[model samples]
Target: MAKSPIVFAMANPNPEIRPEQCDGLAAVMATGRSDYPNQINNVLAFPGIFRGALDAHATDITEGMKLAAAIAIAESVSDADLKPEFVVPSVFDRTIVERVAPAVAAAAIKDGVIRKR
Candidate 1:
């Protein structure tokens, strides 16, 4: 068995398969629609990434910063609260940007691409 596969149907407007079809099957289900849980939108990371880069005065956006932002986003969902429906934090979560910003800033500093200390 695949051991409960992760599925990202993530099409705009309509997903490849509705989450309802996967009930009791998928380990994680994601789509681009706001109506569904774990909506896989780029907004989950971009704004915070830009904010962190600007805040850090980064001369260049490096892979490290992106990786850090991804980690922050993933960690935003606490292990205790994690569920198939909540693999990613809600986009409206105020802490999303806060968590991503500092992580990205730290990565920028560590990567030595920041224009200022």
Candidate 2:
């Protein structure tokens, strides 16, 4: 345990370990609070997933589609810009929906879960 550990104290409003409390101890620290650097907010997900399903005229929300949405979100951040403090984009990043929608829609199409009609 020499290297810094990854910690996710994702609790509503109050995380188990606030970022400042852990400070340099954790390599990557995330919480449910928006004020923190790496906030694991659900807002960053659902909307785009729904939009993509609708756009693709999907009949069901498949696991493939969910994975696609997650990948899209992670891909939103460039490797060069990636850091412990900025693992994910903000909920209001605007491009999240833009990127996620297409990716999810594509996944639906690939999964053959689209509307038959």
lDDT of each candidate versus the true structure: 0.91, 0.92
Q: Give the clashing pairs for model 1.
A: none
Candidate 1: where are CA atoms >4 Å away? 1-3
Candidate 2 TM-score to native? 0.92
For candidate 2, the per-residue lDDT at 57 reads: 100
Model 2's lDDT to the true fold?
Answer: 0.92
Best by lDDT: 2
RMSD of each: 1.7, 1.4
The digit string of per-residue lDDT tens for model 2 on 15-100 reads 87788878878999999997888888889989999999999999999999999999999999999989999998999899999999
Error of 1 at 20 (Å): 2.5
Clashes of each: 0, 0
Q: Distance from true position, residue 97, model 2, in Å? A: 0.7
